[model samples]
Target: GYILSYNGGNIVNAKTGEKLFAQFLPDEVIPILYRYAKEKNHALLGYAGNEIITEMPDDQYVKEESRINKMNIRKVENLFEALEPHPTKLLMTGDPADMLKAENELSEILGDRMDIFRSAPFFLELVPKGIDKAKSLLRLLSKINLTPADMIAFGDGYNDLSMLKLAGMGVAMQNAAPEVRAEADYITLSNEEDGIAAALEHFCKRIFKSKRLKFRMWFKYGLKAQKLLAQGI
Candidate 1:
């Protein structure tokens, strides 16, 4: 299973892609967003974060969406109705002022009931309050009776900080921002250099005290340096 929206949303069964739970834009916050969209000011733009709606191409899509708003800011005549029943999450624009606008206007409206934060550089997410990746991972661990010590989390972004901190072994990518790197237990190679594979190799070597296990498997597959080993004699 994997956490989305920094753990506010989740895919419970990874292989089959099952959704166990989700959070949405609260009712009180919607109207404020509606006013913001309708006013067409402060660049506070957004879209109805449902999957099907989001997949619709810009041209084929009926609603007028914004190119400036990186979220695609789907324009809807009836904002509430357009959001519909399955609008699990809301992806807001990344503009600093746009983010600030929501905070200033809906901070009190949302209060403790909602979560509004900048989990990434490109988008601001809205999820249920107290919902985060670490919390969900903990719940999943509880069911399996596995503690954080059994987990090895990998991350490369701001949203990953929580999980990285909570994991038994958190490995951050070389490309990760400085803050994310700080939260990691160890910094690995960059994503482009196969950081995950590299980290796993190191972890496994530490476990077995040698790379022999991997070499044995390689030998069985007829992909080994057998000549070099034999030359040692």
Candidate 2:
């Protein structure tokens, strides 16, 4: 079974699913953690089938707003009521409002058959947590038979700093933290300002000029970052 981490939301019937994974993050803390991200207007990506589904016009919202608007309690309740009778292993994570709704509805429907377990917090931000991006990335590297010395990374946030520090070549954005900038081997423009483009252009001009690879990595990453930031919703 795939490892599941919770950001919010709830499980309806843990019995029906293989495991119910919940990360105990307070409803109040998410917004504060996302403050800089929200201000930057980043979009998150979700995979649907083979395609990536991104949020539209991403922006930060208060907990109350997330509950009242994003959660849509009545709609969630209806969905849970509809799905509880079936046996489908669905993995989910979200906000408190939705989790409570699922818990209450599923408990009424499934009763003692349900098995829900809350996972410890994997604090991606604020260093010194049980599990995080660095650990996860190291796991990924091991799976791919690679090491930190072989990696080149690009990122712009607190959570990414650790990997940036470890990677052989760490690229930081113009808008990234001062600490990140200091650690980076190179600095690119802000995501919105064709930072990736600038970096790729430099890379192409220096290293891959004769290869004639028209597509640029910097442009690609920069545009991607901008798109992510914009669609964070």
Model 1 segments more than 4 A misplaced:
1-6, 16-18, 37-80, 84-86, 96-105, 210-233
Candidate 2 structure quality by residue, lDDT tens digits, 63-124? 22233224322222122223322221222233445434443543354334332321111111
Best by TM-score: 1
After superposing candidate 2, which stretches have Cα over 4 Å from the reference? 1-128, 209-233
Q: What local distance difference test score does each model get?
A: 0.63, 0.45
Reference-based lDDT, residue 173, model 1: 95
Query: Model 1 TM-score?
Result: 0.65
Residues 145-223 of candidate 1: C-alpha lDDT, one tens digit per residue: 8999999999886767888999999999998889999888999999779999999998987878656877778778654
